[model samples]
Target: MQGYDRLAAVMAADKGLSIFRSFKRLNAKNLLYLQAEIVNCESELDEIIEEDKNSGDFFREKYSTSVRCLKEGLGDETPKQWVKIRQLRELLDKYNTAALQYAQILRLKPPHAKDREVFQRWLKENAFCSTTAEFNQWFGENDENGGDLVALFGRYENVDALTRWVFRIAIPCFYKLVGYRKAKGDVETGMVYFDDDKIIRATRVTSTITSSAIPATSMIVLYLVNHMAWRLAIIVVYNIGFSMLLGLLAKARRVEVFAASTAFAAVQVAFITNFPRD
Candidate 1:
């Protein structure tokens, strides 16, 4: 049996899906249909108002009470249609968040939408666990695992480019080399995490390449090119590559990338200033 499957079995007993204690997965199409149903019911309510003004009195009283709750809730307004719309909006927000995170996992723009982009996998992975229902949690929430890809893999943390390359290019190349004779379902390139310990290992190897190789090459190039302007040009080119690497592999956020790139540039500037090409 697969190690992941065994690990999953060992995790504490399953409590099943979260519904009574929490919300469930809801589709945008269904939500839209619900809005249509609301409109239909609203028309019925309107007809009731026209037919029996007396029943309308009860609705008015209820509306008045709801308005008071709205005041407490929003501090406050009668709202565009009804206060229930706000609850619907909140539910929509939750679903939008899950869609985006799933997209993040897919490395696709706007996330692999649970509805259509990757509906089958989404159905298998999501909305059942209380811990995973409201959010994608990226790797997911398990009793022992804590969703970091930490267990079964070590403490090293990264969702990185080298592993992604392995999944995207290397795995396919290997299959080709072996004439596609590998066991069926032996490897999967498309996964939420690609969920590998190899990611951590590859991250270290690539990190070493960046840390050591770039500087060594930069030093050699600076020495070979005597012209100061040409040296500055080389530094700029390398800096751009550095920034891109930080973004692609380091998972560095925009500001972190900017700061690190800036610091890297500053170091280059200081080096060129102090140790002129002789």
Candidate 2:
């Protein structure tokens, strides 16, 4: 009876081991399928972009909000098309993230079943949490209270926010384009930001839908200067007749002034051509 009981215990252990091994194999197969699916989706997206390159009418029509058109296909199908593509890519990204984290957790090889269970639970909870704050909180860590990754990348709060928006709005695109993980540590130098801390905080909620070669603050200043310059030019042109009445040589003065204006215009053109707007 004692011998039979010992044998039964050994058989149970063997069954558990077999089950674990089978799960590992299944996971590997799923990961491979997901990666292949991502590649296929990427190729299809490229084809779509190429087809719409001429007038970019596809992009324009897709965004149009006209009431009559909205009732038809454009409102529903156009947005829906992008949404479906995004979901596929997002799933692939989550798979990759999970695999990487799981490999790390496995390497530690916890000595007890309880330890292993804890590690598994941690991975399950943290794997899909989008932001570092959520991940830290899930682990029972006070992310906001501590000197967290958010503070370290304080320079890039705006950029990070935009990245999140891009991911949410363009799911397929978010997955295809490599994204910066909102972890609580150093992000790579490739992540962009503004010099002004105030700008970063202020525009943290702003979208990066439009690309700008210059910093947002600098771009704003340039726009204001140009607007004021146009107004100043208008004022100067309006006062030209008043200047002509100041002297009998007003006609000759006007000719001289016109020649000077043409020369200045040529100089301005040369400057603009040499230094293109970012």
Candidate 3:
């Protein structure tokens, strides 16, 4: 009886030790996964910043060159002059499209409705030509050389001003958004790290309780088996029932751990998806 008691104690101790070691390992792995995610977010932010800088530089250079070409084409009155004007108009359209894209990437707010309405009214009053038909009508209304050229130059200046306005408002707001996003990422990372620590501590407590309880339970079972010979069969049945219950509990714990990991991954996905990357 004494030998059997020692064997039961050894088995219970071994099971408890194994559970503790496995949980500790799982905690470490979870921490590593969280750290990796944090690093990925940081790298993505750096890439976005670099791409924005390159885009801004490209547009600025192209805008300057386009302005220079328009100025040089001002004096000519040939068919080639009209073709150059058409090409410049197309280029300005492209610039506007690019500027809108830049603004979207920076998450800039649009102008107020009243301001847009006023700007549209001003364009109509000034007979600002956007289409080829409007341009031809305006050109026919003015003298071919002096007034027409001056009107074209004025339109170009207005377009340039609009581009500058978008950049001026969006660029500052972009920097602020970047700062806000970085701070938010930091806070989230800290929260995840803190939660991981708490989980590990809780796991440690569970393991300690499990380790202490297993041996005490085994000893109690051993005493019952020795003192009550007739109830030994009943004790065996109870032991099997308890063992099955422990197995189910361990399985549930594993499922819970997996659920937690999935939840963390979902949080990361939500953050990345919600952020404007344009």
Q: Of the candidates shown, which would achieve the greatest lDDT relative to the real structure?
A: 1
Which 10 residues in a row give candidate 1 its minimum summed lDDT?
Answer: 14-23
Evaluated at residue 80, the lDDT of candidate 2 is: 39
Global CA lDDT of candidate 1, please?
0.51
> Candidates ranked by lDDT, best first?
1, 2, 3
Model 1 error, position 149 (Å): 25
Model 2: lowest-lDDT 10 consecutive positions: 147-156
lDDT of 2 by residue, 97-118 (tens): 8688556434432122322233
**Candidate 3 lDDT trough over 10 residues, lowest sum:** 147-156
Candidate 3 matches the true fold with a TM-score of 0.19
lDDT of 1 by residue, 147-233 (tens): 222122212235566555665567556666873664353222222222345545776688778767777787778777878999899
TM-score of model 2 vs. true structure: 0.26
Instruction: Estimate every model's Cα lDDT from 0 to 1.
Output: 0.51, 0.40, 0.39
lDDT of 3 by residue, 118-179 (tens): 33333344443556554343223342321212110111122222233333454336546663
Q: Is candidate 2 or candidate 3 better by lDDT?
A: 2
Write down the TM-score of every candidate.
0.43, 0.26, 0.19
Best by TM-score: 1
